[model samples]
Target: MATAYISTPLGSAKLEGDENGLNTVTVLEQDEPESKIIPDVLIDAAYQLNEYFEGKRQNFDLLLNPEGTEFQKKVWSLLSEIPYGKTLSYLELSRRLGDVKAIRAVASANGKNPLWIIIPCHRVIGSDGSLTGYAGGLHRKKWLLNHESPSRQQSLF
Candidate 1:
């Protein structure tokens, strides 16, 4: 697997992938050195992520190959269908998955999402529109949501 680290507005991001596809994209809590030379296979992902942070890109078009169980993969796939600047509730996600009773399982699978922003696990919020669990921490989740918010706040100079 090829690995590359890049800097973002939130923090350092670690990307791993190869010829098959991108395996994961995660923001590291601890600071890590950015790669001076990104692997060829990961170059697109790195550049897209940089564009996302810079507000130049909204949709991702890189191949992904996240590792997970069948159910987790299903959940992640559904997450990717969520539109940019939109949020979905766990209950709604469960319903979409065809089993509202599987909310917990759905939430568990959402928590295990490996692609980070690319899969858009951050777009899943509480039924009450509250920001809930995020492996990258709620602060990062909030930042991501605000970054994707349709209404951008303008600053007066």
Candidate 2:
């Protein structure tokens, strides 16, 4: 698989993929000298991601092959259904999956999502509308939510 470092508003990210499809998009604190070469698949992903960050693209159009178990795949699939500028609680996600008892499992799978914003995992929040666990950090999660919301903006003062 080929890989390359991609810089984003959240931070630097490592994108990996091949002709089969994009495999992973991981956040990195520093650039790794040994990172794989950027392949065409990943290049397209990066361009799409740039458009997403700039609010020009609401939906992605790239091949994705996130690795996970069947149950995790199911959870990720449900997460993708969450519309832009909206949020879902872990309990709600569990219920949607037709297994309320899987709340914890659902949250676990959410944390393990490899696609980040592309998979829309950040749309999941606490039941009381509070921000919750996000692998990329809560601040980034808040930033993402705000970015998707039309009413949010930084104050000049």
Candidate 3:
């Protein structure tokens, strides 16, 4: 597999992938050195993620290969459909998955999402509209959501 480290406003991200597709894109709490030579797939992912953080890109267009159970994969897929700047509650996500009673299970899957920002798992919130669990920590999650908020936060030129 090939890999690359991308710098972002909130933190740096580790992008990993291979010929098959992009695998994981994780935000690192600590610093990591960017690879001098990055794979083509990882290169594209890193570029897209950079654009996303800059508000220059709204959607990702990369082949993804996030490893997970069938249920988790399904949950992650739905997360990808949540439009940019929009948020969904775990209960709502569970309903979309055709099992409202699986709210906790859906949240569990969201917690395990491997693609990070690309999968948009950060958009999922508590049923009460409160920011809840995020593997990347609540601060980063709030920053990302605010960055993507559609209600124009006044452009910086």
Candidate 4:
């Protein structure tokens, strides 16, 4: 596995992956030094992430190889399909997965998502539209959601 670190508005991010595909992109609570030499396999991932933070990119287009159970993978797969700037409730996600009764299971899998912004776990919210738990923390989740929010214009005086 190869590793690289990059700084974001929220915090420093650590990316881990190799030839098979990118595995994980995790944001750390504490700032870390950026990688001086990013691995070739992760170069694109780093670049794309930078573009995302810059608001120049909306969707990611790279091969991913996250490690998780079949159900978790399925949940992550659906997460990627959620359009940028949109949110989905946990119950809605469970319904899409064909089992409203699996809301907890769906949420568990969502919480376990390893790809961070790439898999878009931050897009999932509570049924009441509240920002819920995030592996990177709720603050970062709020930052991500706001970053992805469509630009709004204010009335000129």
Candidate 5:
């Protein structure tokens, strides 16, 4: 798999994929020295991600191939349909999957989402309107949500 790293507001993001499709986009602790130069395969993913971070793009259009179980794939598929700037509770996501009893499983798959902002697992939240779990840390999650919010903070004099 070809890998490319880009510095994001949250941290350094590692983009992994190849001819099959873009696989994963995970945040790192800090900006690390990139090992490989951006490959031809990863250019679009990098550009789209850069646009996303800049708030100039809200959606992504690229081939994706996230490795996961059948059930996990189903959960991730549904996650991609979630509109930008909108939040879905874990319980609601479970219900959408046709089994509220599977809340825990759904949340677990959401947590394991590999595509990061592209698939938008950060859009998932606690049922109690709280920022719950995130692989990239809660602070980053908050920043992402705020970034997508239509209610941009405007300075009025």
Candidate 6:
């Protein structure tokens, strides 16, 4: 397994994976250098992430292999279908997954999403139209949503 650290708006993040795909993306309090040499895959991931943060890219095309339970995988897969600049409620996500009662599970799966912007777990919000739990932090989630929907801003002029 190969691991690398990359900087983001939220903080420094640790990415770990191999040829199988990306396994984990963990947020860290501070930047930490990897003991091993940075692999091409991790380098590519960092570059893509930088582009994403710069608003130059709206979607990610890197290889990913986030580990999770079957249900979580299903939820994450559905999350990827949400278009850029769009948002969905946890209940809506649950409904799309064929069970409105699975809202809790769907939210849990969203929280466990390992690919961040690639998988778009940040798109999920509360049913009442409020920002909800996000592992990356709600402020970052709001920033992501706003970045994607710049047109929604009200002009003072």
TM-score of each: 0.96, 0.91, 0.94, 0.95, 0.94, 0.89
> Relative to the true structure, how large is the alpha-carbon lDDT of every model?
0.92, 0.86, 0.88, 0.91, 0.89, 0.84
Residue 121 in candidate 5, Cα distance off native in Å: 0.5
Reference-based TM-score, model 5: 0.94
Model 3 agreement with the true structure over 41-74: per-residue lDDT tens digits? 7878888887887789999999999899999999
Give the poorly placed runs of model 2, Cα more than 4 Å off. 31-37, 154-157
Model 1 Cα displacement at 55 (Å)?
0.8
- The candidate that wins on TM-score is 1
Determine which window of 10 residues in candidate 4 has minimal summed lDDT: 148-157
Q: After superposition, how far is residue 17 of candidate 4 from its true place, in Å?
A: 0.5
Query: What is the TM-score ranking, best to worst?
Result: 1, 4, 5, 3, 2, 6
What global local distance difference test value does model 5 have?
0.89
lDDT, candidate 2, 28-133, per-residue tens: 7665553345566688888888899888988888888999999999999999999988899999999999999999999999999998788999999999888999
Instruction: Give the Cα error of residue 137 in candidate 4, in Å.
Output: 0.9
| TM-score-best of 2 and 5 | 5
Candidate 1 scores a C-alpha RMSD against the true structure in Å of: 2.7
RMSD of every prediction: 2.7, 2.9, 2.8, 3.1, 2.9, 2.9
Give lDDT: candidate 1, residue 26: 86
lDDT comparing candidate 4 with the true structure: 0.91
> lDDT order of candidates, best first?
1, 4, 5, 3, 2, 6
The local distance difference test score of model 2 is: 0.86
Q: If both were scored by TM-score, which would come out higher, candidate 1 or candidate 5?
A: 1
Give per-candidate clash totals.
Answer: 0, 0, 0, 0, 0, 0
Using lDDT as the measure, name the better of candidate 3 and candidate 4: 4
Q: Residue 154's C-alpha lDDT in candidate 2?
A: 64
